[model samples]
Target chain A: MELWFSEDFSGGSRFGARVTQVVASHKSEFQQIDILATEVFGKMLVIDGKVQACEMDEFVYHEMLTHPALLSHPNPRKVLVAGGGDGGTVRECLKHSCVQEVTLVEIDRMVIELCQTHMPGLASRLSEDSRVRVAPDDASKIIQQARNMDVILVDSSDPVGPSEALFQPEFFQELHTALSEDGITCLQAGSPFLGPEQVVKMALDLKKFFPVVHLLTIPVPSYPGGTWCLALASKADWNPRGDSGQLIRQRFQDRGLTDQTKYLTKDMLGPCFEVPAFLMSIFRREQQAVAR
Target chain B: MELWFSEDFSGGSRFGARVTQVVASHKSEFQQIDILATEVFGKMLVIDGKVQACEMDEFVYHEMLTHPALLSHPNPRKVLVAGGGDGGTVRECLKHSCVQEVTLVEIDRMVIELCQTHMPGLASRLSEDSRVRVAPDDASKIIQQARNMDVILVDSSDPVGPSEALFQPEFFQELHTALSEDGITCLQAGSPFLGPEQVVKMALDLKKFFPVVHLLTIPVPSYPGGTWCLALASKADWNPRGDSGQLIRQRFQDRGLTDQTKYLTKDMLGPCFEVPAFLMSIFRREQQAVAR
Candidate 1:
């Protein structure tokens, strides 16, 4: 007998992986989570029937999500990760030597526990790092008290159900309030091809609170669309394209984190911000709407 | 009842689209071709059980494959499209005002005929354009006698079975001889993530014939691995990054092709060449092998 795991995107498109067996399945108060061992993608994590991450390409997502924003800030000492129950964001955050503390606020303790047990490659650092702290609470509420944060990484799921509040305008406003003067915030923006309107909506909302707002795309095979996006917002003028190569290399060297990364590099800083013409048009239309 | 079409990538990963109905299915002299009207992707062309192009994201593939090489050349008057039976490449090449003639050499006549009837949106220009000349023959044989071509776009399928000859060292050498002194040749190099060795092998082979060989990647949803790469080779010092903004805009204006394009633009030329660091490392290793 052959078993398969599939996820349907916004349209009628679907992606599937051949599964060997279901490792774990549980329904937390928030969502349904399933862990499966797959033939191609190794261990797979599915949340509410959506493939969150697979072992094959999870590094691309975790590296891209954490590195760019963290490197942009001059010194990201106090980092707050919201909704990253997988612990990949915290693992990446702990890589930086300048990072003194990493506060992970996840509403579901079950996600953290399950991931720590099943997906050790991603969640191992959560338990190993002395500087890491886990808070089982709502991310939006936690951000209210998160002051003096140098970097805030909202590694949340899609904007639906419990995670919808994370993408709201009020949450963005609270994120701005929580950040230090020169801090930066990074959040997962949906695929431009799959959910163009949703991505544009988030960018427009971020524009209200941030002086510098940039969108970057990376290829994540497990995602709905092959291409996934990230939105970085900062109080100061922080352009990812303007990232200094020498400084990035020096930081990596100082942290002893040069060989640990699989995808993130100083050379990728500029290219990641190259939004295609179709996506650029979406942003242009949003700008026109604001002008009107 | 529901119908579905699926394609498997290198690492046992698969993508499926729900089909409304199968429009056409035939076995030509070369390969099995199927055309389906998908629920979301509209008309999809499948060759040998592999999804060649879907109506939804075909523009992204055709536009990215043709425009970059054509725009980089000083004067692309004569163009050759090999194995583009669906006629999407011919359609894009016809958009350039400077392109006086487009010679499309396809191995399968049935693929063209069915596409012309079923996928009119893609193959319409092949019959309508006086500049296009269709030759139902093997691309390898046709290129042997070809000469003085400004741009040669090998819009062939994967390097397997009937299309395997397109990626041979001799085919690349013929492509080099057939090009004008300052001409450019673009061919679909397989996905770096899925078929890394295949991509590396092709890059190394092309390095021997062309003075300048560059690889660019685009998000092609229909193709295997989601992110597909194109290898562009030139005899002259034709750097896509060196393409001037004024020239691209002027060409667009003179051609009266500004609004018709969905993806290609002047800004995309430079960033497209900005390959990821992971891919750069592969090239680096190949270079080290060459050095040794």
Candidate 2:
């Protein structure tokens, strides 16, 4: 059996088709979330005919969010994942044997339940992890009083609708107070290639609250234009080249991590951060134009 | 007054505005080409609302194509460039004072006139080069009988409507016969990210004719996905690492040949060839599936 999902990314239109046998089909409260766990690739979470998440390309997002922060901090024993109900990020965090605890604060508990029930390939392994706890609650208010965390990952949806608060500077201020001095955070900062404005805006906002802010990019097939960006920030001076002690280079076939990754790789690390000169020049021109 | 024209490449659609004075507009025979010679980014060539070529970014493509061949051979004094009528390739070839002559075979005279008439920034530089001789002829038939050439560069359009012959296996066979024993050639293979199949086909076809076939990638904002691949082939084993002698390494920039580039850099070379795991597995599976 086979199935094909088409996303008219240029016009933001989506359509799906059943090429083979249908495993499951339904509608959820958030949107028409359909789970099609394929044998070739992994589980795929589709909403409104557009692919919300696919297991095959999820590692690009999960690794970019987790690895930068985990490697930045000296020791990351305790971690917090804000809004990743799919368990993919949690699964990646649990890979670190040094990490003893992980708390996933997702506002929509239904996303977690749907993923667990329909997309087992994505959320199944996390259910067996003893050090992980899935907490269903408002992430902004929940992290207001939290403290002593090594890393906090904001795996929220886009900046509108239910995830609007996640993109605000106030939410970042809350995250600023809820972490230890050595704490770091990485969040998906939209598409740098297609949405350069969003990247510049997010980097500017995070720079106001954090001492260091940098942007990274990764290519995913399911995503529009096949490229996306991740914003990394910390409360200390951060340089990817400067940090040497805690080296965490990700590869596809790393024993336990092998079965988890579909697209993330070690060779792709440096190129992901290499922004094109044309885009960088636009950013500079806009900055100088605005100053005048 | 200095004039500058910039193309808004924010999304899939590209639109160019006249930043200086409103210029005349007309259609060309080769394609719907628009020439906007500017002061900042050099001459801009617009085709079908897409930036076909810009003087600033053209150097990266021409340098990668010319240097690898000229450097690989002991002393490449004779060169032939197929379809690079803009004379960008000829200009780069002229850099080697050792080169006595360069033959530029272009199919369309319109392209040459367009550059000469409007794009003085690109064309004026070529008029001064007495070594370059512009021959109006079909490149496929032009290279067949040619002999004793130290280097031949197939700088044609993509393998579609007008360039279907360029990608054919027969053209590569003729190219193989035209070069000397140690002679080399480099063709612009399309984006590996979006056109993986095209790159693989070219690699396999070139391998049948040449002993050493290496694929190099450079990022170009005008191209789809900001990635471009180059296919190099020679009768002998041409190793870029081995060829980095004192002569070449001295000119080699820390960031690849990016000073002459707007996008292609040293950091972006390897990742351009690194296909996603799922894509690799699919390629492997298809090969295996076809063999069975």
Candidate 3:
């Protein structure tokens, strides 16, 4: 008999993998965190029974989450990441020399400790840098302390428990206040296939603050859905997927990050902004309903 | 108690869903076929214990498979679909008013019969049209019988059992022989994450017979890995994702298929061809080593 880890979705669908060993399991003040070694995904970090990050594919999620916003921003010196205990987002943010400071406001410190202990590849960046600070406090409160942040990334988990507040309109209002006039906000918006309505709702909420909002689809196989949607919002004329490949390449070269990336490329920038045709019509219908 | 249908991948990963009801189970001469009413996917067709097509997301796969090949062609009048018993590919083929005739060559008549019965949304277009001819025969043999075809779509399962031959050089050679000078060939290449080497291997083999070979990724969340690949091969000076959105939209209008598509869109055509940056480097490394 083989050991397995499975999570059932609202649609009664499941995404799971076989486990080889249970590295560590801890009950934090907020949620349960576990470290498991898996056959394919390598060291797996599980928080509240959800797979947070695995060695095999964290690059795709982390790269998509971090690089798009950072690379597209004109000068991202001050960064605020809410609830990415895995530190993958911070690791990508640290790649940019333009980033002078990073404030990681995660409510669960136990989750960060476990990731640092096991998933060092993702979680080690914060400790090595002098510019980084870990708040380990509730983001809704800590976000108020952040003012004029050049880039704000909400790497929160699903909209449940501690994260439910992060999805509310009040939080969007806070994020808007925390950012500079030209600041950009990017977050894991949800699955377009599973909950396009929720994604649209989040985008509409952000639209109340930001002038430009774009939803991007990234391949995150470990998620309940095979793909995840990310929303990019900004007050300036910042286009996520509108840049040409040559322009994107120039940004990478100018930033000295051409070869530093593993997943993001000049070709990937524009393509991700495309809403699939099936979802395009769905998005229009939802937006129209919300508009009324 | 909940009844679940689980399939384990070679990488120790699993993708399964709860079954509301197992509508039909048949052991055909070639493989085991199952029609299941799934909670989220609506109805699903499983072959050899692998999730083949589900009603909820089949449009993404079929539209990506059919429209790109049909639209890019200057004039796709004679279309040949190899192993698409689900008729989703056939249905998409019929959408193009440019396609005067479509030959659906599926080996399993039972699979076709089952699909026609249970997945009418995917399989009903055949009987409704006089242009379609159902050839329930082996693809390797039937492919040789076809010539001067404008477009050939291979809607095959995993390269195992009955579909294994579809990935061979001999079959690709036959596809080369059975095409008009400008004929294009598109097939369901394997998962880029799971079997990228196989995708590259098939593309390299086709490069022997065709001047251009492009592998495009499609989102098929029902599959183990949320995404799958499709390879486009042509002897003419053709490109799968080289055209602009305006050009792709023009193709749709010219073919009179603007309103017929559910997933394929002007914006979607170029994006799917972006070999993700991680996969892009791997593809190049493989191609360079092969070049030596």
**For model 2, what TM-score is found for chain B?**
0.78
Chain A TM-score of model 3 versus the true structure? 0.96
Clashing pairs in 2: none
Cα error, residue B37 of model 3, in Å, equals 0.2
Best by TM-score: 3
Whole-model Cα lDDT of every candidate shown, in order: 0.85, 0.67, 0.85
Rate residue B277 of model 2 by lDDT.
50
Q: A1-292, model 3: which lDDT tens digit per residue?
A: 7899987888578988889999999998998888999886788888788887888778888888887777767789999999999999999999888899999989999888888988899999879999899997999898877789989899988899899998988988889899998888898899887777788888888888888888888777788778888988887875544453346556777887776777677667778778777677776887788779
Better of 1 and 2 by DockQ: 1
DockQ of model 1, rounded to 2 decimals:
0.55
Q: Write the per-residue lDDT of candidate 2 for residues A197-238, one digit (tens) a residue.
A: 877778777877999877776655455545577888898675
Where is the poorest 10-residue window by lDDT in model 2 chain B? B8-17
Q: Candidate 2: what lDDT?
A: 0.67
Cand. 3 TM to true fold:
0.97
Q: Could you give candidate 1's per-residue lDDT for residues A1-292 as a string of tens digits?
A: 8788888886578898888999999999989999999987889988999888788888888888888788778889999999989888898888888899999999999989999999999998998989999999999999998898999999999889889999999999999999999989999999877787889889889999999888888888778768888998989874544545346545655666666787766556666777777888888988998899
Per TM-score, what order, best first?
Answer: 3, 1, 2
lDDT score of residue A138 within candidate 1: 97
